[model samples]
Target: MNCPLQGERKGSVNRIMRELNGISVVVPFLNEEDGIRKFCNTIDKYAEKFDFFLELIFVDDGSTDSSVEILKQCAFQNIKQVKLVKFSKNFGSHAAIRAGLQYASYEISTWLGSDLQEPLELLELSYEKIREGYNAVYIEKKSIKVSKANRIFSRIYSWMMRKYAVESYSSGGISTIVFDAKVRKYLNENMEANSSIMLQAMDAGFKSTVLSMDFHERSAGVSKWTLSKKMKLFIDSFVAFSFAPIRLVSIVGVFIFCIGVVIGISTIVNKLINPNVPVGYSTLASITALGFGITNISLGIIAEYLWRTYDAARKRPVFIVSDVVTIKECESDTQ
Candidate 1:
């Protein structure tokens, strides 16, 4: 079907106020129709507490439900500023996030999902810390009320993240974060709206500070991030940010080669000494191990960048403007 924004282009829309600076909260939402009021209220509360000129930019990311209308409902509050950019289709969170960052007319840019597991109170701390002297202030989850299995996996994930991605610091700790507009511009201009948009923020090459916090139960509709999606995010983060996984392939190859040499030497010694040691199992095992080793090496090297390149090559437009609610589009780009 043709997008709503395209239809709306011929109709009335939200009006933009005079642009303000300080902090812009970019919330990327899909089917968050039920939580818009609560989410906006929390943002209003935190904005007052922090005493910053705040604007809430909700990117609808092509929601196929009443979320756009719900966002429109909150637009009446106009607490400082409330803006929504409804995409023509589901360009996904990363695209919505990039749009918010680009549309953000502020000094610092931040994003929080509509799920509400991340609290508004932490934004106060993040804003304060960003002002103090850091390029970015990442909110690290100190505790989360997930299942025991999730907690264990989170630990292992964080450990692997620390070792490979950040090089020296720990990750998976950061759930929310705030960064200077300059750092955000780097990704907004260059990144594909594929996955793990946060990884781009982390890779911005700045002295980032971490603030430990806790994740609470959601305050609204169910999460869009399934276990499978989260697993893909974990893999994407590693593949997008570091090459340690591929390096492991090389390490495994060397270890197997060394082991094979030793086994061959031992087999010859045994044959010379008694010539009766069984060779069937050893030969079969060696062949299996060698095959596995080569397969892993090939997979790692081939995958190191193939998927990302494929996504880039597809060159999907980040967001389709079904219509404009606030900002006017240039004739060339829109036409």
Candidate 2:
């Protein structure tokens, strides 16, 4: 199908051929019906200026709303190539992005959210940098206009990732990223169910750089990411990428064992000093409870790791595509 915006300007064909290159923009969204149309329009506008052929891949993470329908409608309206991958159920934004990447046809693939908070102009800079030999270009948030509590939480999360998961974790937010085929291949091959894509990309040992940008407010729809989801992402990122949790359990176990020995020696010394002294039930109970709590926590952490190992071994597909609507099919139907 020919680009719909191609004939809008005089001598546009030559410009497209000379300045524009093909790029696949992978967008993962869940229940983003309010903003999907605006998001697509913004992408179209960017495509016009950059003169690049856009292969827009929208992965619908089982939106119960009209998101998939809106995507289909937009696909029919746009001249740029559009592909919709509808999930059977809500997998996750990361899973959706991974699914999109598998079907991407272009060498340069860019990831964007459906909320339209991130500026599309970053693509131009990212494209330029990638052309200059960078394997990946990441759009980093210089600052976000969020609640103070959220800001604090974000800082703590960032610190945890840097201290435990990966040192470059600060550069790994899922805002906007443009990567070449090499980076995409690396990610596809080393897929982890619970890991953050940005961290995975950072660990891929690619020549990458971050472009700092101001994060804008969402144009429409409330963020589907709840506190629980944020916490899950944090834990998943750490577990999938770092062995620090296991190390922490080991350290705590050793500390508890040493404390137990010290307490035993102290109790023996006290009993010898005062054989008639009554045993303090409260002290015995407190020590027993503490030991039990620590032991249970340690077991829980180990079980978490073991469960993830079993999940990986099962090799379940990260996402199941229930339906796909492509631009070519839409064009054919219209013709």
Candidate 3:
């Protein structure tokens, strides 16, 4: 997709009134046909109350359903423009959101999920905070009404991230974020695949404000966030931002080596004291297995960093856009 306010030759550019008082919203979805119309209607009602305009950028991340068709058929009230980006295949939600950011035109931009779990009020509140000179506004959930297992995972992940990675990361973890054009442009230009965009934005040292809010339960469509994908995100967040894991490997290696030294000394002293004692194979086998296990884990952590480096070196595109559709508004209507 083309960047905002540039002459386009490589990809198409869908023009909007850049000077309009508005916020651009990027909604990324996968197989959310059941909620498209309802989401649009809800946003429309919310937008009707705003004095500023709204730009909705919907990115379809390779949904094998009627989502695109339903999206195309839907209409919005009080929205300045509607842009749809259809990916060739499932490129992941972060990739989809990044794709939408490339086309953002307003002074402020934020992303929301198609499930409508996050309230539109968060966007408005974020806008106010951004106007107060914060470059980014993070909506941290006061309470997440997800499953017990998911909530536990979220808490652990959030704590780990704050402890080892970004110190300023939200305690409850971040889901919805709103940033001004400056941060948005920075994120768009500096894109890294297999990385957490939220973490990336936070690590950039931009002035950010966090709001403690409650997120609603999903009103429609099942979530596409699988456990394996969450694990990948966890690994990616650490690998991309923190060296704690690599440092941890070193720490564990040193610790294990010290223990081995102590054990060896004890064994030698025991042998000298009791020459009749037999060297136990069970003890040796246990030590061997423990050493191998630690070694493999250390190697695995190192490999994560190396693989990300190799992937970045290859300069692969984070996402491939197969199609783009823009619903334009009349010049008079924009005014």
What are the clashing pairs of model 3? none
Flag regions of model 2 displaced more than 4 Å.
1-20, 75-79, 171-174, 328-335
Backbone collisions counted per model = 4, 0, 0
Query: Candidate 1 residues 39-58, lDDT tens each?
Result: 87776655654555566777
For model 3, residues 2-105, the per-residue Cα lDDT tens digits are: 22334443333233445555798999999998888899889988887787767899999999999888888877757767899889999999999999998787
lDDT of each: 0.70, 0.78, 0.86
Superposition error at 215 for model 2 (Å) = 0.9
Per-residue lDDT over 162-260 for candidate 2, one digit per residue giving the tens place of the 0 to 100 score: 888878665334466799889988888987797788888987779988898887788888888789888888888878889998999999999989998
User: Which residue pairs in candidate 2 have backbone atoms (N, alpha carbon, C) closer than 3 angstroms, thus clashing?
Assistant: none
TM-score of each: 0.80, 0.88, 0.94
Span of 10 residues, lowest total lDDT, candidate 2: 326-335
Model 2 lDDT, full chain set: 0.78
Best by lDDT: 3
Better of 1 and 3 by TM-score: 3
Candidate 3, overall lDDT?
A: 0.86
